[model samples]
Target: MFTSQGPSLRELAVQALSSVERGYDLLAPKFDGTPFRTPDRMLDAVEEALAQEEGSFGSGLDLCCGTGAGLGMLRRLCRDRVTGVDVSAGMLAEAARAHPEGVDLVRADALALPERLWNTYDLAVSFGAFGHFLPAERPALFGGVHRALRPGGVFAFPVGAPIPVTSPLWWAVAGFDTAMRVRNAVWRPPFVMYYRTFPFGPVRTDLERAGFTVETLPLPPFGLREDGSPRWRLLLARKPAAQYG
Candidate 1:
């Protein structure tokens, strides 16, 4: 769902046909007006969870940081500096406009970060960006986050409980994913956004392989589901202390 200020149908059609970077560039200006931006309530819960898990960080990084929505959370959790990296220059420009003072916006692909960034951050985060990545790319993306963090540093994000397969919401998401697959089959530069692609089990495995010790904490503020399971959980993963020079 989108607000009145969100992208028009023509604008959405344009974005859908472009490459992911260009699509996001076209979408950046009105991004916050869409449900695509992580909600403040979820952001607050993530901040609280980070505070409890890691206490505080010296410097923070936001991977695929779209329009710097998560920068405020990074600023609250980190003491020194907060950097936002994105592949879309348009998105980075918007981020610069929105977070002029406290944040640094870098235009770079998360899969191909600069060596100078390695081990430069104490905390790394991403919000509402994973769907853009294919499942096979998770290892590289997580590895980049690991590379960006200092030893004992963290990479955190909030993940929601899976929609029930019996529910209409499930059918809706499934149909959306199916349509995306069909579109990709017939299109160039596929827009890779799938809801069910990044399940927690495989994600934890990828994080572990990328050298992170992972844990999940319930976000109670978002409340529970019918079975008393949390509607969402915050993933807290730490890069292990360096073993050798």
Candidate 2:
């Protein structure tokens, strides 16, 4: 579901065939025009939830920030500085164009953050980027986020509920993930993206192992399931103020 301004089918095909970073670089310009951009409603809900906790943070970061969709949300939530980091230079260029004033765009891989960034952020958020990481990579990704934040700092993002196996939506996502796998199998610099891989239970466990006290707050914007469980939730993981040595 892309807007008229979004990339054409051929453009999308080219992106899918390229490496994840290159693919995103190709898609960076029209990224916001696609459904891939994190919705404002989810962003607002997270801002509200984080606002309830401690005082305003000094700096914020959007890890795997892409074209900086989450940067604006961080700017609203953090009073001081807001920065976005991604591996795609093209994405950073577009982000720079959009946020010229007081926004720092860093081109860096999320998996291996620069040592200078360790424990430097007050808050961090990522939007729709987790699926790019494999399940085995969650621990390191979570650890990097943990190290990027100060003690008691937060790392948050929205996670949607899994579609029912019986639903057409399930088939759609399954088919998409399956096709992505097939494409990666046949392609070089494989596009390491999958939809159905991230699960809440394993994520929480990894977060805990990474020294974060994880919590989930339901997002009303996406509403609830038939069983009244939230269809979408914001995962807020805090690096504890003190750690047992």
Candidate 3:
């Protein structure tokens, strides 16, 4: 599912064996050519949904903004400043080259956001980066996002509906996760990317614990499954405007 401009099989193998940060660093230059890059249609759907929900925002933040694909969406939605934070310097470099003006790129782990970022953004969005975080890391990850936003600010991302057990896609994801587990068990500096770890129910619970009031909006462009369930929903986790002591 990669273009001719994408990384070669041997290059991908080398990346898979490296740590998450380093692997992404190696992959950053060609990241946009790969299927791993968030699709423009998905970003468009989210931008439309967010505009309908909250007409316009002030400043915005993009968590784990690899190659800054989501920054354009933020720029469209936010009136003031737009920031993209990532752990990989190489990714940030590519992002910088693409978006040289009207965007701030920060190199920092998503789980441990700097205090300067706390309460600074009116909106925050992440695209296709959650798999790198383990289930146990959700609390910290969500908590950091909570702290990063102002009161009534939002943290939103698209989440796909669970694949049916009978589907080939489900089996493929399951196999990938199994292989990742096996690799992590034996490899040094494990690359913690698993497709199955971020379920909607558990993730909503974590967001709630992180002081967000959570809700979802169906993205109609992606359509629904055979069972009449939305194929994708945008998770809107809002920090409350007021909280009692």
Candidate 4:
């Protein structure tokens, strides 16, 4: 699923063996050519949904903003400044090159943002990076996002419906996770990407524990499954506008 301009199999193999940060650094330059980059259609769909729901936002943040794929969506939705944060300096550099102006790129771990960033943003969005976080890390990740957003601000991301057990995609993901487990057992600096870990039920619970009121809206453009459920839904988590003593 990669173009000739994308990383070669040997490059991808090397990346899979490296630490997440270093792997992304090696992958950053050729990222936009790979399937790993967030699809433009998905970005457009999310931007449309946010524009319709919130009209516009003051400032925006993109979490784990690898190569700043979601920066364009933030630019369309935010009237003020937009910021992108990632742990890989190389990815941030590539993002800066691509976006050039009207966006700020920060190299930082998303789970532990700087205190200066607390309550500073009106909206936040993330795309395609959640798989890199293990399930146990969700609470801290969501908590950091909650603390980064201003009161009444939104943190939104799209989640796909679970693959059916009968589907080939299910077996493919299961095999991949199993392979990752075996690889981590034998390898140093585990890559930490898994397809099946972030189900909606557990994710909603973590978001609630992090002090967000959560709801969802189906992205109609992706259409429905044979079972008539949405193929994808946007998770909208809102921090409360007021605090009670």
Full-model lDDT for every candidate = 0.89, 0.86, 0.95, 0.93
Over the full model, what C-alpha lDDT does candidate 4 score relative to the true structure?
Answer: 0.93
**What tens digits encode model 3's per-residue C-alpha lDDT throughout 113-230?**
9998988999999999999999999999999998899998999999999998999999999999999999999999999999999999999999999899999999999999999999
Root-mean-square deviation of each candidate, in angstroms? 1.3, 1.6, 1.2, 1.3
Instruction: Return the TM-score for candidate 4, rounded to 2 decimals.
Output: 0.98
Write candidate 4's Cα lDDT for 75-149 as tens digits. 989999899999998899999998999998888898899887788899999998998999889998999999999
Arrange candidates by lDDT, highest first: which order? 3, 4, 1, 2
Candidate 2 accuracy as lDDT: 0.86
Clash pairs detected, candidate 3: none
Give all TM-scores, in the order shown: 0.96, 0.95, 0.98, 0.98
Q: Report the number of clashing residue pairs per model.
A: 0, 0, 0, 0
Better of 2 and 4 by lDDT: 4
Worst 10 residues of 2 by lDDT: 46-55
lDDT of 1 by residue, 1-245 (tens): 99998999999999999889899999999988999888888888899988987798899999998888889889988899899999999899888998889888888889988888888998988988898889999998998888888898888899999888899999998999999999999999988888889999999999999889998899989899999999999888988887211
User: Which has the better TM-score: candidate 1, or candidate 2?
Assistant: 1
